[model samples]
Target: MTLTQDQRSLLTAIAQPWIDTSEWPLWANVQHQFDMRGQDADAIFHSLPRVGNEVSFASGYGYAAPMRAPIDPGHMVRLTVAGVSKLPRMRIAVGEPFMHTLRHMIDLYTRRPILVDEVPKTILRSGELTAALPKLDPWFVKVLPDLLSYEPAINTGGGAHLSDGSWEREVTRSVMQFRGMHTVEEYIEKTCEIVTKNAAQTAPFTIEEEQPMPTEPERAPYVDLALLDDLQKAAANTHWKVHKLIALCQGLNDAYKAGNPYVCAAMIRAVMDHIPPVFGHKDFKVVANQHTFMTQRTDKIHALKLVDFKDISDDGMHRQIGSSVPVLTMDNIPQPIRLNAMLQELLTILRKEAAIAP
Candidate 1:
């Protein structure tokens, strides 16, 4: 009997344990043993699970037929085992029913689950998985890794207000430090435009004052120290925290590279807001707040110190402050936060003045 192509493949796989390419001598003996039957046998095969009697086999070298289903599509049976002499010699009986069963089984096995896409959603909220996420902030629903919560060093360039509503940007990086002065100037100008464009949303102002307290009692502040402590503990984990800090820092670097001042500020603000109050260390606060002002262009630039914003009444309106505001310096700012201390202190002064207003 002559075997069909599929049958031949199936038979070869079954006979792999005994007869194979390397066992030419054994194969010759098996062929001779089979030739004794005095008939050319034809066999059939399919990419499906197989059942008994329909497939028959014979081998002098103890080649075992595929007794079980192949676990994966990639696995193919070899015609021989490592030590062929120790294995039982075998012969297979191939027939029509085996091919039919295999075809049917393969057809059924090919279909995948219907809801594979929705499977991930089920696992995403699993208790074990949720435990890995950072503790959620009460104010906002975000769980960023702790390391990303740390601040990176940033430098904000200064600019001067023009007669128009626009501000002329001064290169913020050190003069000797700038690789190309003209290019840096252009970048600063672009940054100023981006900041001014978003100024309405991120309105910078000196807090004037709060309305005087009413006689009616306000709610007692419920200081959630326990919650804060838990979040702080989570923030200390290197994998959880460091990754977010690196990602945010990299994002800022990319935004600056893209010449997107607004994006830089927006990204910094996002980070600042995301950080849980638990990790409110001085360095983190300074970095976040400083970067915020820099990106927003709310703070003063040394190069533009002489520009009179009062006379121009242009974009650099903050420079227009009157004598009522004290000269702001490092000494004037609160020691707790140094990033935007001068600007913040100035705002505090302005607030005091406003509070005293009749």
Candidate 2:
């Protein structure tokens, strides 16, 4: 399959969160439990399938000693399932949503009375699967191996002594570390509001000098030969179309400006590289303002920026891990200094690339 460089970059970026903390056993067990109960495990896996469909289909299994809360024993269990395709696969760790689906399905299935003990309080925890499965196993199956169920090691006051307590401690209610997720509206309105307000309040007090718009014969927007050929086929009157091309270029610029200014500048440079002759003094000015706007309205800029790339440091500072420097602090630096630094860096790269002989 063909993919552009940026498209490939985006695909990898999108998949990284799932790839980082992949746990297969928990996902397999959850799938198996649902599968035994006539639930279509394949359907769930297919719903939000991985970038390559084959990645989700590869399967393997192993046995695991029973584990306590926070440690999923199921993830460690040994098992194997057949894949539909013979292609290689990428394994992903089971995420919270997968666990929730299993928990909810179990709750629905166990509404009727089939046991004496209260539905395992471990299951009640809504997060602990290890303790709850033991409770469910005794009632549902026979000759269940002791290894299938896990009991917590009891702490007997002092530092050295410990008790192997199967039922000594009572299961406390499971406190979900991550509760409900917020809707897009709630997050955008609340988080972005604070970000926007802070940016406006903390913006640098740079003087706005009104410069006259340039009057020298504005360069006619140029279209690539290949694209021009395509346009000629579509339009009945394929004149030089200077005005239309100019308007189209303006439209693209406007679209970029309407979004985060940093993004606008980035897109402007990107388009300029592929579509030649549009790169001029005015284009540079437009791109420059975008940098200034982003730097001045940093809170909004950071908020709009993707989480992973949000915290770019000032050029003078070495890149430090987990540094939370304020975006608009103007100590020893000129107005929008950080923005200017980044803009210069971007422009330098572009100019360097343009100078290279093809």
**Per-model tally of clashing residue pairs:** 35, 10
Q: Residue 69 error for model 2, in Å? A: 41
lDDT scores in order: 0.29, 0.29
Q: Model 2: runs farther than 4 Å from truth?
A: 1-14, 20-182, 207-358
Each candidate structure's TM-score, on Cα atoms with residue i matched to residue i, is 0.16, 0.16
After TM-score superposition, the amount by which residue 114's alpha carbon in candidate 2 deviates from its true location, in angstroms, is 42
lDDT per residue (tens digit) for residues 1-358 in model 2 = 2334433332333233223332123445545555576764434333322221121111101111212234342233211111111112211222222233334334533453456866543222222333455444221112111111111111111010011211111222221211242322232233233334434443345558454454332221122222222232222232122323323334433433243334333333343332222223344333433433323565334323322222332222334446573332222222232332333333343444445625
**Tens digits of lDDT, candidate 1, 1-358:** 2334544443453455323321112333433343565532211222322222212211111122232332223223323221121223321211122122222223322332458557211111212222432342211111111110110111222222222212222222222222232332232333333334434223334468444434322211111112222322333332233234334544544554444444444444444444423233333334334433322443423112212211222222235566764333222211212222322432333344445655
Q: Evaluated with TM-score, which candidate comes out highest?
A: 1
